[model samples]
Target: MIRIAVIGQSGSIPEEVERMAEEAGAEVARRGAVLLTGGGSGVMEHASKGAKEAGGLVIGILAGDRTDVANDYLDVPITTGLGFDFRSLILVHSCDALIMIRGGNGTLGELSAAYMNCKPTVAIETSGGWAEKVKQTAFEGCYLDERRTVEIHYAHSGKLAVDRAFELLASKWNEERNTGVTGD
Candidate 1:
């Protein structure tokens, strides 16, 4: 099972973008994939709601120990006591791949962390926010850094973005297995 984290804005997102995020989550669930999120509001809420409705497991990597703020749709809530900044790192580390929707600074931080850790990430570019900024800010269109640690793939729709994510993940795991252990 692939641990797919959904990174996006919390607290009141645009109506259309929120719907896109929900559709993304429903697609994730329908495909039998795990849905992970920061677990607040807006996009996260919609995603979790979609996943739950689709009978998929939803995990929330929350900023604090309190589960009260977490969406009702979550199957499990990881109460990361590290606050927002540090908890974001946990979200990146825990996932095999990530799907980014319309996001803010917090989502951007996760994107950077995913790049640093070589985790494959797919962005729904049509959603806006960091999804739009990343194409311009990335080191070489796709790469987040000059090291070529991980390159972000862009898709026009949530479904396509998820598809790209899985493809990248399979390719990445294959490379990791073939490369084996390296000293230098």
Candidate 2:
């Protein structure tokens, strides 16, 4: 199973963007993909709700040991108790891929980490927050960095973003197959 981490803001956001996030989550579930998120409120909550409605397994990388903070829809809550900052790293590291919704600075940090680790990611570009801002912040008005470590797939709709995410995963898998894993 390919784990997909949905990174985005945890507070107030535009209703349209929130709906997009919800649709993204629903699409992931509809495709039989497991949904992963920071497990807080706002966009995370919307995504989880959509995924659960679609009968998908949802995992929450919670910031604390208590389950109270977790959204109502998570199937499994990994209570790292590591506090927000450290747990965010856990969220980035455990996933096979990431979907970036409209997000804040925290989402920016997740994007940076995903790039540093060469994780495949998709971005819903029409959403707000960092989704709108990051293209400018990235190097060469294109990529996150010179390493080309992580390719950001952009889509105008939630369903399209999730679709592109799967494409990215397929491409990455193909690259690994063709080049072969080096450690062996």
Best by lDDT: 1
Which sections of candidate 1 miss by over 4 Å? 181-184
Residue range 1-184, candidate 2, lDDT tens digits: 7778888989887898789888988989999889999999988999998899988989999989999978899999999999888888999899988889888888998888888877777888788789878877777644787867656767888888888888878877887789996311
- Model 2 steric clash total: 0
Q: For all the candidates, what are their Cα RMSDs to the real structure?
A: 2.2, 1.6
Per-candidate TM equals: 0.94, 0.94
Candidate 1 has what TM-score? 0.94
Query: For model 2, what is the error of residue 54's alpha carbon versus the real structure, in angstroms, after optimal superposition?
Result: 0.5
Tell me how far the alpha carbon of residue 94 in candidate 2 is from the true structure, in angstroms, after superposition. Answer: 1.0
Model 2 TM-score is: 0.94
Residue clash pairs of candidate 2: none
| Model 1 local distance difference test score | 0.87
Error of 1 at 112 (Å): 0.7
Most accurate candidate by TM-score: 2
Error of 2 at 37 (Å): 0.3
